[model samples]
Target: MLRCPNCNTHDIGRVGTNQFYCWGCFIELTVNDGKISSIHQVEEDGSLSSLNDLFLGDGEQDSISL
Candidate 1:
């Protein structure tokens, strides 16, 4: 099970390959090489804002190893 970096919620929904959606914070999660690399929040304008820095502990280094 994957955990949401933003809300620390384990309620993540798989949306695609290496991609997940966080129901807790409604953020888009993108995993790479078994690690979470990017986090985007869906804006009211239907745009995405990068929230990776806010969620990731060590930015790109917090990714999981496969």
Candidate 2:
């Protein structure tokens, strides 16, 4: 299973094709080609705030569950 690098939580639920939501931290994770291309936080206004810079490492590639 894909784990959240921040919270190390595995409570990820698929919200769309190749898109997953982290129930633990209430964030959105988008995986493409077995890599996470974007991370966003869902706001109360139903908007997205980019959280990639906080979570994505310098050379870390996105991960996918088998």
Candidate 3:
């Protein structure tokens, strides 16, 4: 089970082929090659705000098993 990096919850829902939405923290997670490539916060206006800097470190993506 994939847990949200922000909330550490398993309440993740698939929004796309590799995109997932975290119900726990309301963040969006994008996966590539079985790793979390990007993370974004869904704004009230439905815009995506990058949260990669806060989660990923120095351009490094976090690894996760699908």
| Model 3 lDDT tens row, 1-66 | 798999999999999999999998899999999899999999999999999889998888778987
What are the clashing pairs of model 1? 35-63, 35-64
> Per model, how many backbone clashes are there?
2, 1, 0
TM-score of 2: 0.83
Query: In candidate 1, what residue range of length 10 has the lowest lDDT sum?
Result: 57-66
RMSD to true structure for each model, in Å: 2.4, 1.6, 0.8
User: Model-by-model lDDT, in order?
Assistant: 0.77, 0.84, 0.93
Instruction: Between candidates 1 and 2, name the one with more favorable lDDT.
Output: 2
**Cα lDDT for residue 40, candidate 2:** 93
Model 1 backbone overlap count: 2
Whichever of 1 and 3 has more lDDT, that candidate is: 3
Measure candidate 3: CA RMSD. 0.8
TM-score of 3: 0.94
Q: Is candidate 2 or 3 superior in lDDT?
A: 3
Ranking by lDDT: 3, 2, 1
Candidate 2 Cα outliers beyond 4 Å, as residue runs: 57-60
